[model samples]
Target: MIVTADLAMSLDGYIAGTGVSPDNPGGDGAEPLFEWIHNLASWRERQGMTGGEENRDSELMREWFDATGAVVMGRMMFDTGEEFWGDNPPFRTPVFVLTHRPRPTLVKEGGTTYTFVTDGIHSALEQAKAVAGGRNVDIAGGASTVRQYLAAGLVDEMQLHVVPALLGDGLRLFDGPGLGPRRLEPVRVVDTPLAAHLTYRFAT
Candidate 1:
């Protein structure tokens, strides 16, 4: 199974804006980054909402959701998104959360269960792969989590939904050290009015 990551990033490379907290999860000026999928039919269906545009974006969303059998994310992402996700999370498969603090397994509706992994990224990925049953393991991130995987060379592919807006200061997807200068082979590009869907595979 391949390990993949999907993120909606701003033109300036920020995945999230500044002043991010549980109260202000997406942070300031981050709305533009995800405005593309907000009204997609596939995205709305996963959130238990109804009536959204059926277009190329929606099709891509459906493809990703169907391909992902399990998910891995950081603790901060879990904490911030827990309240908003409610009982039935969008991930119908299992999810392993990377965190320092230990917590009991949290089972939510719609086949999503949060298994907290305190050990590290490797252990979390191992657990996720074990349950993935050959399907892809998606790195569902808040920037930091994706960075860790990329640094460790654990990610096989990455799909970036590049939005047009720019966040002057915030969490960047490729910030910090130890990420480059690695080569990325372009796999696909789907340009839309809201964002440009760019997919790449790590060059060996």
Candidate 2:
């Protein structure tokens, strides 16, 4: 199974902003960053809603959602966005969360189950992969998590949704020690008014 890190970032290269809170998970000035996907028809359907326009963006959203089997995420993404996800997160799959604190597995109303891993990144990835079976293991993020996986060269594919906005100061996507010079081969590029969807595979 291949590991993938998928995320949406601002044109300035920030996955999130500073001073993240329960009120502001993506942090300050980050709301516009996700307006693209959040407004898609597929997004609304995932939320159990109706009445949205269909377009290439929404079609791509459906493809992304259908390809994931399991997810690995950081604690910050869980704490900040868990409640906002309601009882059923859009993931609809097993999610292994890397955290310092250990917690019991949380099963939501839908197929989504969150397991907190206190051991390490490898442990979380192992658990996620095992549950994922032959399907892809997705590295769901909050910048730090994606950076960890990318730095380790564990990600097989990376799909980035580049929003048109710019965050002057916030949590950047590539900010980490020993995380650059990793080569990638562009696989696909889809352009929309809201964002540019870029897909890359790790160069073998």
Candidate 3:
């Protein structure tokens, strides 16, 4: 079972802009950061909605969704995306949220079930993998969570949808205590007008 992570980041390495609030979830530059996948037919289909342009971007999004069986994310993502995701979230799988505060199991309208993990990062990953069975467990992040997983060397595969934007100061995907040095083997690369999809596997 591969532990995977996927993110749409800016050219400056920021996953999200600063001043993230209830109103501006990804902050001021949030829209531009994730606009690539927002218009995909796969995104609309995941939301149980219809009518969206189908293309390579949409196909990529669909592949990611299909590949993932479980998800792990930070508390910030849950808080900020709760309202935006509405009653049904796009991830139609079990989600393990890393948080300080413990909450009751939130069962949504779709197959998605939010499980809060207060123990530790490894604990969350373990739970997610168990639920995922033999399928891949995705680390759906908000920077901090991704960093923790990466630093621990738990991620087997990663895909970054690099958008053409520069948010100098914000939450970065690699922000954390020094991860030292690491290497990645390029798996695939796809270029588009809005973003470039880069897939990599942790070097063995």
Candidate 4:
């Protein structure tokens, strides 16, 4: 399965701007820093569909949607707060959500469930792989979880959405005690209305 991490970044290399505190903000104040995503398309038609013309960087975006089968996300992602499709999210396959503590499996209408896995990203990856059915397993996350897979070299591809802004500091996309140099092998680059999409293959 494919392992990919998608994120919007500021020009100064900040993901959530300086105010996205994990404390009182719980990363709320930084919400306006950068945001994204779009509407659904008829899978049967095979006709490409995105939120708007903004995703002129359709090359990688389309590739992501087409390749993704199973999604392994971090805790923040399972909050069911990304209600793009109302009470139900669009992802139909099993989504393995990585968390530190246990939680109940939250099943939604569009076939996506918030299955919390307290075991770690690797365990989540294993579960995602099983249900992946030979398709790509996407690492949908909030930095730390992506870093977990990155440190282990579990992620195969990464699409960096570089937005034109600067927060100077905040949560870094990749950081920690054990992390070292993980070189990026550039695959392709394109422009989107809100940002520039850069595709890089991790050197394993």
Instruction: Using lDDT, give the best candidate's number.
Output: 1
Comparing candidate 3 with candidate 4, which one achieves the higher TM-score?
A: 3
Q: Encode model 3's per-residue lDDT on 53-106: one tens digit a residue.
A: 799999999998888889999999899988999889999999999999999999
Segments in model 3 whose C-alpha atoms lie over 4 Å from true places: none
**What is the TM-score (0 to 1) of candidate 2?**
0.96
TM-score of each: 0.98, 0.96, 0.96, 0.79
By summed lDDT, which 10 consecutive residues of candidate 1 come out lowest? 29-38
Distance (Å) between predicted and true CA of 78, model 1? 0.5
Task: Tell me the TM-score of model 1.
Answer: 0.98
Clashes of 2: 0
lDDT of 1 by residue, 130-189 (tens): 999899999999788998999999999999999889789889888888887899999999
Query: Model 4, 1-204: lDDT tens per residue?
Result: 677887777777666644433342325334434344332233212323334432354445556666777898777655533443345565666888877778788777656776888877778888888887888888877777777888788888888888777666677786676668778899888875667778899886
Q: Give model 3's TM-score versus the native structure.
A: 0.96
Output the number of the TM-score-best candidate. 1
**Candidate 2 lowest-lDDT run of ten:** 31-40
Residues 153-173, candidate 2: write the lDDT tens digits. Answer: 899999989989989999888
Off by over 4 Å in 4: 18-51, 58-60, 80-86
Q: Which pairs of residues clash in candidate 3, taking residues 3 or more apart in a chain or in different chains?
A: none
Better of 2 and 4 by TM-score: 2
lDDT of 2 at 120: 87
